[model samples]
Target: MAILDNTSLQLPKENPGAEDFLPLLGTDHVELYVGNAKQAAHYYISAWGFQPLAYAGLETGLKDKVSYVLQQDKIRLVLTSPLRSGGPINKHIDAHGDGVKAIALWVDDATKSHHETTKRGADSYLEPKTLKDKDGEVVLSGIHTYGETVHIFVERSNYNGVFLPGYISWNPHYKAPEVGLKYIDHMVGNVGWNEMDKWCRFYEKVMGFAQLISFDDKDISTEYTALMSKVMSNGNGRIKFPINEPAEGRKKSQIEEYIEFYNGAGVQHMAMATDNIIETVTALKNRGIEFLTVPASYYEDVLDRVGEIDEDLMPLKELSILIDRDDEGYLLQIFTKPILDRPTMFIEIIQRKGAKSFGKGNFKALFEAIEREQESRGTL
Candidate 1:
């Protein structure tokens, strides 16, 4: 379990001259189109420790759809479902099951963000629109990204509502305890073959992101499967998106399986940050969240490669968490089995000691673990 040489880990130097025209404040909220918003919201609340925040439906004057907003610290998730038999929300759910629809970004000016991105050749998903309530007013704009997913620019400086203009405060009596899950660390999207560079370029030229790191098939492959990835980050380093595409593998790679089941390129998983992964994961497991597990051999020499850390090795190894290190520091991460029925989307729980890089050193062990799951599903 020797770690790869530091030279093999590719962390590209940031371009000093790179200008960020469309600056983002942070992730506003992730909206998912699900078959049943009520049940989906309950799952997130009970299993993932998200508390109820707001709601929108007929009671809120929304005729065509309903939405339930949940929150945990800085992370917000909006679960939406269609009210009618046929519409865009229903269509999206039919095609992709329960998956992320919008990666909403907080910004200062929604109009300016839309103009900047559209002028740079990004497809418009939502024209700049202003919504108002007694609380205040908020501006929103959006642009299409890889697959059917979209990036929504939300300008809420003028608003003081619970969630948004249309949504009312949803004070649910059953509140789950917080799991210490903080803000979103990053979101990874899986694209089609030969499409990784295209989306990466879109993030670079349109969104003004810089390449933080890159992984070829050689860096992230097992004997049976392979994939390529490149991480893109915003100017302030608050947002990160790592795009992955399947490579030629002996069998089906996870990216290929995701693209196939999701019906196209889409968000694969979201990595959520935590101050104490041990406590958070323990709570999540007790609440019925299952994580992928690597063999016992993975931990036999993990400390040898990752070197010294503040936390004890026994707990991390017992929980099947993977560790990796870079020049900055080391990070602990573990992946969940696909949460949806299609085996398309999942979640990653990550705790960074100081490391800025993804776990390149854990690639083999992680992918082998994924391959094991694929074998069980007969998709490998």
Candidate 2:
């Protein structure tokens, strides 16, 4: 799917002669290794209003795994489960409950992507391979990143199947109206202690991404919790990954809690973009989606900090949406509680006005809200 058309989300100014060996079209798909693809698919469809797009499993000649593809606008999610026990898929499930396994990128040359990454120190996950069916051919290649997460390069300019060749159109009787989720804004990952810089450099040297921004613990800390984050972006600013690590604090940091419960470092949340957060949030909440809410006091002084915005303050305050502004523009965002029981993975709904920066201004209130949830869960 083509990326959502938004002038505010345009590419930022590129770095001076930064290596563009691996140019990406955009995020192709994010595949999560879930315990049950069917139930997970149902939850996203019913709660998030994602339409079923495709399916691949035993019926499609894949014996070991079953995958359900769901799409909403330009965002596509692949939920997969191992059909039988005792394999790499099972091992992954055992290691990290339900979490993201791969962040696929749309590219023009999968072979070149793989060659450049591996030659630059990334471990090979999958050699370049061509998959074809009636529609056309697609070339796929992959390389390993932090923890068990992989970046799969997908060359689909020549393909036109539902998802790929193996998957068939999945049109189920159950369907819901679109929730206005346009596309993925950014995805954040939590790593083990002192591993944030390692992965950040990997993205810089291996994947040719530049450090767009960085937040030390002081910039993103509360009274009792702290963590550090560094934002990495590709050449054209289409992909942004904010890698985070726990910092010393009086209480247990949220990143530490995620690492412990998740059995290691992994994706913490995937942020999706929408044009209208008030409507999008209203639809999601009415559909049983739960979000982390800051106290009403957060909004009392927000306008003074963020300046004037196009949206009204009452609806944003009532919905508990957080606002932040950069030199470019402001953005509205809200975070959901963990979608799974492990408290490892969650989702963020963000609407950028003209800002290319993440919600750094809201980190204090956001983390305080998270600390409250962690206290209730007894993980703090």
Candidate 3:
């Protein structure tokens, strides 16, 4: 039996002390630091179905950094590269590969969000600054999080600019069809030893977040590795973050392996929501994205545990997308291998078809699958 926490998905109820979060303002945008912005943008548009939305580079007068913006549904991603070498952007890429650098939070007031988080001890990355152009003015502020990652507060109430002032409206000849991905579900981070609770408290006290769920090292441990995680949620449940910390194991846990390769703490996985995961995963696989595979025997008794799924059982087996259901509804979810060389970043496809729970039932299978990767990489 799983050591289900009190805060695990349990019907219409929510975790205590978790304030009523207003429906998330939706994803403001996800900014990533990469080695090459142009190539990264192509990967997203040509392969991942994101349409080019904005652009800023040497041509845009930014001599130090270049950024490419892409969007699909409510999510936007800004891929940035250092125009000149040896800057902080280069350092970030050197450390974490092409990983998430900032998760910009959409808010009604950028200044207020900055004051609130900074007063609560968030180190200021960008002072509340307003940028204006012919289109309009946008106010943005930011604070540092674990590793080189950051959370930028975007106040766009008075802005009509394409993106920010520096970026201009980008019109690309290529625009891929929407992949059915709607919004961000949750972002997972991997920290060094015993640091999970530290960041958990940072969110609780600094950002008005609350612990939604937790798993001990034992619950998430493989035979040769162990890690601990705690889920934190914003008021509206729109933003959820799962923080992971490595623990002593016979060999090395995935978290430790990431820290070793990435050189520090950073994002581990980003879960994006979709209404039709079966179709989405099918599309993703056909587009050349690789997903983990599990043993055939694992599927033999799945129904005996989670009951029936609307999808054809054979397709689920064929594609390797895992399905699980709770009292509320069933959700389809699948994880991808590390997108970059360091093994610090990956993507998750999630579809909530009524069930409100994270796929707790898939934990054993998922970890086993991850361990197989670890074995190949010689980390475990």
Which rank order by lDDT, best down to worst? Answer: 2, 1, 3
TM-score on alpha carbons, each prediction: 0.96, 0.96, 0.93
Residue pairs clashing, model 1: none
Among the numbered candidates, top lDDT falls to 2
Q: Is candidate 2 or candidate 3 better by TM-score?
A: 2
TM-score quality measure for candidate 1? 0.96
Looking at model 2, which ten-residue stretch has the lowest summed lDDT?
1-10
* Overall local distance difference test of candidate 1: 0.90
* Best model number under TM-score: 2
Model 2 regions more than 4 Å off: 1-17
Return the TM-score for candidate 3, rounded to 2 decimals: 0.93
Q: Write the per-residue lDDT of candidate 1 for residues 250-329, one digit (tens) a residue.
A: 99999999988999999999999999999999999999999999889998888899899999988888889999999999
Q: List the residue pairs that clash in candidate 2.
A: none
Looking at model 1, residue 115 earns an lDDT score of 97
lDDT values of the candidates?
0.90, 0.91, 0.81
lDDT digits (tens) for residues 178-246 of candidate 3: 678788898898888888999999888888788877888667776777778889987667688999998
Taking every candidate in turn, the Cα RMSD to the unseen true structure, in Å, is 6.3, 2.5, 5.9
How many pairs collide in each candidate, listed in order? 0, 0, 5
Rate residue 199 of model 1 by lDDT. Answer: 96
